[model samples]
Target chain A: MGPSLSIAGLEVRDPRGRVLLSVPALDVPSGALVGVEGPSGAGKSTLLFALAGLVAARGHVRWGAQDILALGSERRAAFRRETIGMIFQDFLLFEELSAADNAALSALFHPRKARAGLRARARENLTRLGLSGTGARNVTSFSGGERQRVAIARAMASNAPVLLADEPTASLDRAAADRLIDDLVTFVRRTGTTLIAVSHDPRLIARMDRVLRITDGTVSGDTTPNTAEGAQ
Target chain B: MMAVWNALPALWQDIVVMLLLLAPSVVLGGVVLRGFAPWPLVRAILWRFRGASVLFVALIAISVGMGIGLLAQERGLRQGTAQAADKFDLVIAAPGSEITVMMASVFLQPSDMALLDGVTYNEIANAPNVAVAAPLAFGDSYGAAPVIGTTAAFASYLAEGHITGRMWATSSEALAGTLVPLDIGDSFTPAHGHGDGADAGAHGGAQLTITGRLAPTGTPWDRAILVPVETVWEVHGLANGHAPERGAQIGPPFDPAYFPGTPAVVVRSDALWANYALRSDFTRDRETMAFFPGAVLAQLYQVLGNIREIMSLLVLVTQMLVTAAVLLGLFILSRLFRRQIALLRALGAPARFVFAVVWSFGAALLLAGAVLGLGTGIGAASVLSRVVSARTDIVITAPLGWAELHFLAGFISVTLILSLVPAVMVLRQPVVPSLRS
Candidate 1:
């Protein structure tokens, strides 16, 4: 089962000491599909990165019983590998590698005995994500939507409980974006994996179970979709 | 195994040293790459920047090839010159510079110098344990080949009894060196000197016939024509080295009164100790000088050795500079892929795995360049050897040897170590910032 997230006093600062992201307190239920929306430079992506322990932040970030903020960089990386599956806005595929290899990149750091299983799962994910016959094709040749699907396949291949995506569908066209949204929603609903995505697309934000609005490095509003309790 | 190792030749010993030098890099690579298959990622990165990779490899290959090729060529020339002088055990010349006499006599590069008198010649020939003391009469030529006037015994000794046909039976009958473009029974008139200045008609009626050919000696002498010393004197209007009553007889037993002076006397003895004794006894006189050709050649090699050392240093510096530039280029190239690296890090790839990927990428290029450089070095050495042999008539052969291998091993190890700098630099990049960028 996906783990719940508990955050307290999570603050990220630039080198100049100005706060970039300051979340005083937030609690997220296990298997919840949450969305973060904000203006440009409002630290939406920074929040996602801090959630993944990819950036330095002073906070108590507990995913289940383990607090990732207390972990060293190496252990944080291991935490991300074993628990957090991340997707980037730009897709960030290794263009020279085949789609299958790109999706199975996590296998590079996994133990030898687990690598084949990881690769098999990556292939299965790629096939499930509409990349069945394109496993051996170089990702550079993939369309923007297809590339993001490969990215999704990579994230889903690991079977990590928590998926943190930063503008995952930002580069895709509307139709492609809708298809990706459908895929993400279906994957989340079926597997009950906790999904935290930062996006400005209203089509995507409308589908979220709850949304947090950030402005000027602080959350300005929090609301559940179509509910009176969300107004509070 | 120890006995077998001890029995191995010096070249093989050097090869073992070369392999030992490469062991650290191999061991380090094994440790860093343990259980990790970085090759696919490394291969992908190399393919992504194929142009830069190719350019870096080519740069390394050129530098390595030129360095080792020149070194091998230097050694080849040394060995060829040394081999050429192998037959001349001791050269007795008039009181003059030993370098000049050695060059003139052993290398056939004749120059104006005082000749040893018949009395000095007779003394050398009659010395105790003297096996053969043949006078070397120079300053004559046929076409581009030097005409050396010496005894049948000296010709046989130089050829190591590997003569193809019969030895000369008369003064006019000559033996050709292996590379001389003349056939047995061929005849040619003698010129008074070498090159274009040679008087082609100097000895108008002094034609000599080729009676036999000597096997290749890998020396300047390979292009020479050997005839009886008496014929050279007779053609020059000097008395043959015999009394009138000797009646056309050739070779030693020449009466001192009838013996014309010779530029040098090549002396051999049955015992090595006798040769040393002859050199010492002959060195005492102010009239003549006796020296070992090998010793004189060794002195020349010392000078060549110094030059080689300087060239080696220069090559090493140049290679290091090129490697440094390549490493810097690699660092910049890593910047090109910083986003991808950041992606990997974000995907939870360990920093060490990322380090291995970058390092292995650089190392693969270096190793490919080094291996290709070896082939290029050998090819360049062969071409240079042929050019030198053609011009100097010394059959130089620059075979790829342990020295070149040692250089390559050192190059590979140093560059592989330096390659780590780029990998570390890549690792130091801020992962979040890079991912954002």
Candidate 2:
């Protein structure tokens, strides 16, 4: 359903031109759930930003045969709109908008998606996430767990091939985090959507198909732990 | 909103029509925003920042709307007075300023010009090409409104005027203007001097009978009480304890010792060139002043023109300040929503789309304000015009014209230009850094 990505000479630099990340090469299988594991300040989010072309970087990020980094910024943004759905760590929902409107942003601006079609899909996705009446109420009225669920619903509603979550469970409690991850895994497996989630929580990492461990801005190994080998 | 619509359908329709009329630009602006920002995103963000948006729009509407309305009112004042002035050929007065004569005589307002000898009246009537000379003597008031001492010829000058009760057949009887606010049978004391404040002592306790009422004339004269010259002279003679000799006529040896001063003389000449000749002679004379009312009006309008320029400058500055208010509002919104903009960008909103979102919000605020202001301004102008017309007898009607159209167009353009201030701020931030943290 989506392109397998290959990365080479991928590096991220800070405002003062200091190197923040330096990954020489990596590859991601199509339609797979890959967990990015790293310590604090080890460039876990920067890797995703580069792949999405949200930041300036020196890289050859080949999505299938097409080089994502070689494309211009405008085309890269367009490509991301077509292929990627991002979940921010803080769950930055537009408070003035309804939860259904929050989820419908991904396809609301697309040429082929009618407003009614996008809203219908948004309501469907939000209902699946157990937010049945969220289409009419404001987002600020929802709880933290519900807010993240709405964000996950946004990612799912876009129907994009690649779902990138930036510590989506960072602020959720133990029970809420467990429930959110379970729903995310279920949705990903059912839809065959490729998910690349970054997290340090052991329980979350223990459920991924494979874990790519990075330390000091470089991939150390394909550290697919023995505990996660039996997970669907 | 639905309940209100169901309860009062007619009121709802009226409100909807009024809103649409006030800000027709909102429809155009909505279409424009759909292309770049898409209506959903622009609308959602605008709802959050609606308070600031509404304030900015109201500021624009009041300033621009009131400015145009006041300008049109001023124009009506000038036009009405100018047209009235054109009907008179020349006004003769005591040796003083021409404007005083025009105001005191034709418009029937009080003046301080030293009264000319009744002998001067003889000179105007005897001059070649002189068709009629209606001398005006002012000294008393009926209920504090000016009472004019004029002739039977005064009625012929008005476009529509007729006696209702009967003509003044006695020296103690009076013909009232439509604005006197009295019945034909009632009586009132005539106050001496001008009618501004405390009344001066009357002429021989001059309680006169209201014999007749004249029809309306849309001039200041409508507020006056017209009396026969003999009635005015008799009041003066009675006050001075002198009786008029029974059959006296005006000439060199002023008979009956009647020396009632004439404040103004409205003269009509048979030959057009007679006006220039008469004016030149009076200009050289030491005891008399003569001028065409039209020339006096032109000089007055020159002063009004300078005032118009100053008012126009003030209007322009006020418009700029209104635009600045909109800019300030949008700047605060842009700052408050910086994180949201970054999030939208990370979620695949282009920089162009972000810029469009900021500009569209500003445009909506300004468009709404200007349209509402215009409706309010026009409404005020209409009401004020009628009120002023009734009070002053100067017909005031502010028709919708280029002044209103230009006000709306210029205001919309300037505000749209100022909107770039916030839009540029939205585009200048580094999206990745904001999304990361």
Candidate 3:
């Protein structure tokens, strides 16, 4: 399956009673690393949320021609579990749980796998993210850089094709941010998955296949393919 | 059942006794055990405490209520029965068959009654001990009122020791029992039993004066009339009534007509004598009957003991139900906490291991509540028995023994063990949505 995303005349309002974001139409193909950039309150986050079917929007969000909004909350939660990978801005890690458990927790939410199989996949992902021997340590004890890596591991652990991350590296130092970006791009390319990331960081913006700029409820500009491999 | 409701005042007495026993343990245990629970679990425990679990307090209350009620009932009956026995220390009549039961019955006096040890007046008075001895020559009745001739002591003794009232001191003075509360200044007319004011004509109607009124003692004394004991001898012309002819003891007479008198009913006087005399001086006759208050009460208890045993058994059954209730509540709470457990579940914990953690928490609480409840019940029982002993002579002080305590502990263990049912079910349940939510 060529995991693709489509948004048509989608409108998301700021919960603070303001017009936050709008898109006439947009589509991104599989294996594409897309960068979304905008100033604060320019609704880059809302646009990402609208595309991922996380927020209520006026028009349509579809994944491979299936209307995402048409699913009920429970079914939508299941759909999000099985096919959507989210790297939330707050990390939204269960604070009481361990880092490896956070990854496993998300995997267990998918209603499709046997318990043992889900646990093995969770352990494998944590190991792949360099979180080996840290499965039982509380996530709160993990350093911000380590926590960021754990969040990425959780987002990708379930092998969901469409990865939507709010801010990939807003807190990372330049060197670490570069390395994390390289790692995320390599993972997306290896899995042949679509990546939609919202960030204000220039280094991350420069590493994408395409860049779309958002300003005050409008798509202000689009930079044609200078994709993940441009650095290669 | 209406009697049970009517006994609420007594129930209050029981609750006061129970409070003296159980409140200390409940307050202390609740605080200590609550500290061990997680914050959310503590909140849920408090909520349960405020809900149907309040029935525990009611159980203690009902036990105390019924206990106090039974105590009061026994006390009242003893007082009433003793007063009736004191009215006639001696009932002198013609020596005949059926004498003992005749003495017990309110009716049937012999034809030739004579002056006895005690006196009588026309009416009863409170101070029967101070009254002069009179003789009885007649036993007749008009309209449910008995007519007897005896010394002024008849009036005093019949009063049964009321706070006020004087005994008849003169031959002409008289007193009435229930018949005439208003005739204190009236005269007696023995010549006529019934007439339309005709007996009032003789010798200024015998000039009978009522000296005192008797007090209400719920005894047969409130129903007789009194005259000097000599008056009976005078009417019978048996002026030598005081001579100890057959088997009687002599005592002073109230009138010159019978200057000295022998105790007429020797056996009846002996019965009264036995109660007050030294053990060595006690004597018995062929028609003797001794009423032992303690023995009578024991017999009454024997009749009702089986029912009390059954009631206590029922109480035990109820305690078991309460144990079951605790188990049920804890089981539900464990199931509700499964989301927290699922967090642990996803952390690579085996299913059986996750179940053990939840079960341990529930078992601890059930054990605590059961031990506390049982300890409270026993402590209350001891204190209550002591209070009863101090206030009244009825002794009912039996503490719950080791058997009861062991049963209580076992009940707690079982209750807590059973409380883990829901936790086991939760472990086997799917963890998909728990992980997601």
- How close is every model to the real structure, measured as TM-score? 0.96, 0.85, 0.42
Model 3, stretches more than 4 Å misplaced? A14-18, A225-228, B1-437
True contacts recovered per prediction: 0.70, 0.48, 0.00
Sort candidate 1 into its docking category.
medium
Better of 1 and 2 by lDDT: 1
Rank ordering of all candidates by DockQ, starting from the highest:
1, 2, 3
Cα lDDT tens digits, model 3, A1-232, are 4468887888877568677778888888766788999888788877766665556668778888677777654455556656777775446565566777677654443333454566677677677667788988988787666677777777766667778877878777778777778777777777777888899888877888889999998899888655436544
Provide chain B TM-scores across all predictions.
Answer: 0.95, 0.80, 0.38
**Model 2: CA > 4 A from native:** A112-116, A225-231, B1-37, B83-89, B106-109, B116-132, B195-197, B238-259, B268-284, B379-399
10 residues in a row with least lDDT, candidate 1 chain B: B31-40
Measured by TM-score, the strongest candidate is 1
Worst 10 residues of 2 chain B by lDDT: B247-256
Which parts of model 1 are misplaced by more than 4 Å?
A: A227-232, B1-16
lDDT of 3: 0.54
Note the DockQ of each predicted structure.
Answer: 0.75, 0.51, 0.03
Q: Write the per-residue lDDT of candidate 3 for residues B1-437, one digit (tens) a residue.
A: 67865677965645544554444444434532332223333333344344433454344334433333333333333433433444544333223333332332322232333322323221112122323322343443333334455544444545545524566665555556643444566555454333343243333324456666666544443554555554444443455334435213222423333344432321222243443331122223432232333334445556666766686667666656655555566556555555555543333233444554555455445544554555555555556655643333223444554334444444444444455576667676554344334
C-alpha positional error of residue B256 in candidate 3 after TM-score superposition, expressed in Å: 26
lDDT (tens digit, per residue) of candidate 1 on B142-226: 9999999999899999989999989998888999999999999999999999999999988999889998999998888999999
